[model samples]
Target: MVDVEIIEMYIPNSPSTLIYIPGITSSLTQPELYSTLHQTFSKFGLLYQVSVKNVDSEYYTYIRYYSARAASRARAAALRGEIAIKDSGPVRVTGLSRSGFPNVPLSRYKCEELANFYLGFSGWRSKVLYHRKEESDPLMVKYVSVVSLEFPRDSVSCEGAGLCEQPLASAEEEGDSYIDIITKTAKRSLGEAFLAAWGKVLLIVVEGSKVQVQINTTKEDQFLYNPVWDEPVVSVSEVEYTQDAENEDEV
Candidate 1:
């Protein structure tokens, strides 16, 4: 692996209710994550800070490696998001398998109270990983839904979505690197876990999106917009879509 390091930052928006988590095989820097967050949660803010760490080639090793950083980032994200959002109503956390654990204290924005959406696998199992706390607050978690993204029960759809691209094995064999299982899971699971824990889910999948379809579209566009996954994620000027493919002679 050639110096695979991940950078963590918040999406910074408000009136925020929904949160989408990415999957384990990749990082949240993927365009799919940006698009979903940009479109579905438009106007909302992201308050979490991700910790970049070293991962072994065994992506699943994250369960052990990144746990500490995940905890800190979860707490930080929670604090930042909580303060930024005006909605005192329930917050949502949505994601795939590892991301199902977003409820665990991996970022500032993590907590049972903030859980609103959960799209994941082994949800109950993931939630089982959190520490118990006494409830001083009177609110019951407003859980959205738990959609399993595994083999058999493989899909769903909603007004919003969380998309992720997996690490290509060919890239793995060569020097191309990828995020570890811990970061991937931490990024992926929390929101879906929230749903499984809470229950009123509004799940949607991109069964079919037009090439021109738009989602995760953001406001003001002040973002760290880098599409590359193996290095630190950054934001730059948006790229021109090239509008039309090559005309007959232009090809």
Candidate 2:
């Protein structure tokens, strides 16, 4: 194996998150790139989440690991510039500290109207609450449903207009809660509609009566007209690295 020099671009204070900037070569969509990175990085350690974003037609992958050590090791390996995808050149990896990656205010609203407005959807009557914290971060909020809904066959009506209704007791007899049944039905009926409205969605997960919608807000800053994660992780510049090198020589 060829040994490439490891350049510590930015050492984050916490070192739990690492950003990967891939060379321009692949034509995969943001969601597809996210899936590929998640699967590849999952081998290193337990992952909290993986996000992909496009800036100026280039792709960047932000990976957060549960173990800081795992992130550090990944960063070292990535810095060597050895990791690469088929048809893509080596990627640049930079470690991010907690202070480096600032968390934006996340707000959860109970009103469907507000949710619809933020989600950019119209004629949506489901009681799906919206939770948003970052306007530009690639990883958005995840909605998990605990109980499902029951809708009439012909009219497709839910129990409440803006609230998730409790599952019926009879639903337990069939080994599946009413919430689970309704959640699946809703995904089948309204999943496409939601995807069309919210282009940032990464994946949709349904467990029992609950449905989890994972949002990917990559490049949202451009569309939302706001900048959140666009700021540099650290205030310092590359000069810090040169100063450290000179200090080591003096020692």
Candidate 2 lDDT score relative to the true structure: 0.43
Report every candidate's CA lDDT: 0.28, 0.43
Which runs of model 1 end up more than 4 angstroms from their true locations? 1-111, 114-126, 129-165, 169-176, 201-251
Model 2 residue 176 CA deviation (Å) reads 22
Top TM-score model = 2
Candidate 2 residue lDDT tens string, 134-240: 22222222222211122222233221111122234444557866557555444433332232233332212122112233334331321221223345456854563
lDDT of 1 by residue, 16-100 (tens): 2223332224343334433433332322222243222224411111111122223334334544554122222222333222332
Q: After superposition, how far is residue 37 of candidate 1 from its true place, in Å?
A: 28
Q: How accurate locally is residue 138 in candidate 2, as Cα lDDT from 0 to 100?
A: 27
Off by over 4 Å in 2: 1-13, 20-25, 97-251
